[model samples]
Target: MLDIFKAIILGIIEGITEFLPISSTGHLYLADYFIKLNQPKSFINMFMVVIQLGAILSVILIYFNKLNPFAPSKSHQEKEATWQLWLKVIIAVLPSVIIGLPLNDWLDKNMTTWQVIAATLIIYGILFIILENYYKKRTPSLTKLNKLSYRIAFFIGCFQVLSLIPGTSRSGATIMGAMLLGTSRFVSTEFSFFLAIPTMLGASVLKLGKYFMIGNAFVGNQLAVLLVGMIVSFLVAYISIKFLLRYVRSHDFKAFGWYRIILGILVIIIGSIFA
Candidate 1:
């Protein structure tokens, strides 16, 4: 029962932080450290990655009509545009997929540390604040997904590779990259949502495969824990996605930047004390 409670807390944390510029993985790491789940290291890692599927599904559910090219209610032009969007999403995900596959193990070994997370959180957080201020007076040139060129999409994908460093935050990298490339926050955020579907689904598959290959047996208790986490994350993420979409309309991300910096500092402080 206590373990299940911890799962719920972690799920809530994952759902809330996943869509925000905040790093969900970083938050989960902190949560796990403090709560101390009685699972093996491999199981814990797989649980963390696979539970993100729940958050990803929230985006899919929220934007299903927009993401689906074959929606019966769509006009011909809209369908074509949806297909184009998917193409751009694929383009935006390819760089991470190609580069991330081979580097995964090395990164897991070297980069998944509290110090790295703290540094990235503070660094990207400051960047977000600075960028928000710099662009406050400027108008975005690319307001729509269609306005984004393939080159720009590819560049966004390239930036996503920075997220190979655990706490760098994949959505943070892509959203900042898109904004820097002249795309509006709306388009950048929405594209981030679309891009997450493939990226996270692929991650879940790889993690599951690795778990089995390492001879981790799939059992009832483990299955229950995963399901509980995923379901809770899905529900919380649904509300979070809606909130963020609405929040960005009239605001910039400086608040999130400040939030990240403060959280990073706290993580570092807490980590040092615990260490």
Candidate 2:
């Protein structure tokens, strides 16, 4: 029962931070530092990656119509537009796949430490605030997803390669890159969501495969904990996705930037005290 409750807490953390500029994996690492689960190191690692699939499901559910090229309600032109959008997404994901795949193991082993997480959290947080201020006087060149060019999409994917560092949120990196390339906040946010579908799915598959290859199998309450975590994450992520969409329409990401700075400081302090 206690393990199940911990799962719920972790799920909520995942749902809340996964799409936000705040890094979900960073939050998970912090959570584990305090609420150490009574599971094997291997199982715990797999659990964290696999549960993100729940968040991915929420994105698919919310954007089903926009993402689906075969919907009966769409006109031919709209269908074609959807296909083009998908192609752009594929282009945007290539940089991450090419770079992240080769570095996954090394990053997992070396970069998941608190020092790295805190440093990135503070650095990106400062970047967000500075960029938002800089853009205040400038007009966005691209306000709509349809207007986003393939070249811009590819560049945004390059930014996602930074997210392999653990504390650099994937959405945060992509959205910042898109905005730098002159996209409106709404367009940047939406494209970030689209980019997550492939990125998170591929990551979950890789982690799961590695877990099984190591002969790690869920035992006793482990399976139950995993299921509860995923289900809870799915429900919470649905609400989070809706909230972000509404929030970005009327707000800049400066607030998230401030929050990240404060949180990073707290993590550093707490980690030092504990260490």
Candidate 3:
């Protein structure tokens, strides 16, 4: 029962932070530190990765029509556009797969520390503030999704490689990269949403595969905890995604930037005290 409650809390954290420029992994690490689930380190690690599937599903649920290539009501042009969008999403995720897979274990072993997370949070937070200011005076060149080129998509994937560092957010890296390349905030944000579907799904599968390969499958109670976490995360992420899309239409991300900076400093302080 206690574990179930913890799962719910973690789920809420995952849902809220997953799409935000703030790193979900960073927040989860902090949560797990304080909550200190009694599960093995291995199980805990698997749980964190697997639970993100819930948030990924929220994107799929909300953007089904936009992302779907086979909608019955679609014109040929709309279907073609959807396929092209998927291709761009695919291109954007390739760099992460190429880089992240080989380094996953190393990052987990070395970079998952509080000190590292805090440092990344501060660094990227500052980057966001600076970028937002730079963007304010400039008009975006690529206002429409179709205006986004394959070259830009691949370059954005290159930026996503930076997110291999624990606190460097995947959406933050990609969205910032897109904007710097002349894509508007709305286009970039929506592209980030589409990009997450494959990236996170692949990650969840890999984590689950690793868990099973090591002969550590979830048993009955653990399974229940996992399900509860995923379900709650899905519900919360649905709301979070909707809120972000609505929020970005009229506002910039400066607030998230400041929030990241404050959170990072607090993490550093807390980590020092705890250490």
Tell me, by TM-score, which candidate is best. Answer: 2
Q: What is the TM-score of each candidate against the true structure?
A: 0.97, 0.98, 0.97
Poorest 10 consecutive residues by lDDT, candidate 2: 266-275
Order of candidates by lDDT, top first? 2, 3, 1
Give one digit per residue, the lDDT tens place, for model 1 in 113-137. 8899999999999999999998887
User: Measured by TM-score, how close is model 2 to the native structure?
Assistant: 0.98
Considering every candidate listed, which one attains the maximal lDDT? 2
For residue 238, model 1's alpha carbon misses the true position, in angstroms, by 0.9
Clashes of 1: 0
lDDT of 2 by residue, 31-105 (tens): 987777799888888888767999999999999999999999999999999999999999999999999999999
Indicate the TM-score of model 3.
0.97
lDDT of each: 0.88, 0.92, 0.88
Give a tens-digit lDDT track for model 3, residues 9-100: 99999999999889997898778668766688888777787679999999999999988899998999999999999998899899999999
Name the weakest run of 10 consecutive residues (lDDT summed) in model 3: 29-38
* Model 2 error, position 218 (Å): 1.7
| Candidate 1 worst ten-residue window by lDDT | 218-227
Q: What is the lDDT, from 0 to 100, of the residue 172 in candidate 1? A: 92
